[model samples]
Target: MRYSREHKLETHARIVKKASVRLREKGAHGIGVADLMKDAGLTHGGFYAHFDSREALVIEAFAHAMDRSTERWRKLAEQTPPQKRLASIVNSYLTPVHRDDPGHGCAVPTLGAEIARESPKTRKAFAAKLEQMIDMLAEQIPDVPRKAARKQAMAILSTMMGALVMARIAGSSDFSDDILGAGREAVLGRATSPKAGKPRARKAAPSAPH
Candidate 1:
């Protein structure tokens, strides 16, 4: 018995989806072809039939994982109040829950450093997906200009990622809290402050003119 093309495609997608979760749970280097195949309920021999190579699967899994993360954030942004969304996002991203549960968390702070050493194709896909995630984030900020929104999104993401990384490196709850708390305060403060992103207009010297 042979599977139809549609069935094959569906199976392939299933494999990739499962692989994405596993990749997020364990960094790309932490997983292997056999382990992913078993987790996906497929034989190792079938891996090549679905993807050209592990590199291909890595790219697909990276994109899929990022999509899941951003979609989760988008849902939260939609339901949460606009004024509080940035803080909420920052708090959630820097929590111990997120740090302990890499399987369901943001890939940027999880495997980003590892991905830097990966194939160029994987890096390219990651760059594009990150931009898409930023765009999704920008959508949640209706009051800001497109460029400003994107810049804000980038800043938020950068802070969140950096905070998470530092917390992990610090290896202590107190340090983790301090790192996350400081980052949250800085990001949310700037996000909520009236003068954020605006340049102060310099007053002219009227006496000098006279």
Candidate 2:
């Protein structure tokens, strides 16, 4: 049966949405095309009608997951005060709820390492979404130049991602919660510090000693 163009687009989006969740729950190579199609309520043979290859689907799914992540952050930024938006994002991202639910959480910490081994096209797609996330983060950062905000965003993302990954690896909920708390404190501390983004002045050597 021939589906309408709008229906086909909806089906394609459904497939990508399902793939996005599965790809985060299971790494890039962990789930198969058949399983993803099955979960999306379609047959394996129908996969090609929407995507050229499994890799293509994976790339689209990664982008979709990141889109959801950034959209949530954008909303958080809107509701939060300018001074507290960054910390609000960090707290929301590092919670035990997010830590326990890889299928529904941000794709970066879940799939980043696995995607690094994917093809150039896949890597390129991932990199593009990552940059969008960084830009969203940069916007929440207060009182810094754009260039410095970008750098601070990078640090904030790195800390959150690394801490989340470690928390998942530690195999205990208590430990996981501790990791999240520590990570939140560290990132927010740096971001809210009085001298954040400023260079330290070098001490002058004593002329008499020379």
Task: Quickly count the clashes in candidate 1.
Answer: 0
100 in model 2: Cα distance from truth in Å?
0.3
lDDT of each: 0.74, 0.81
What tens-digit string does per-residue lDDT give for candidate 2 at 152-198?
99999999899889988974456665676678779877422111112
Question: 1-210 in candidate 1: lDDT tens per residue?
Answer: 798999998998898898887988778888899999999998899899889999999899888888887877777777678876655556556665565566767788888988899888888899999999889777776689999999988987788788878877775466665675567667776422111112324211111000
TM-score for each predicted model, relative to the true structure: 0.82, 0.89
lDDT of 2: 0.81
- Give the poorly placed runs of model 2, Cα more than 4 Å off: 190-210
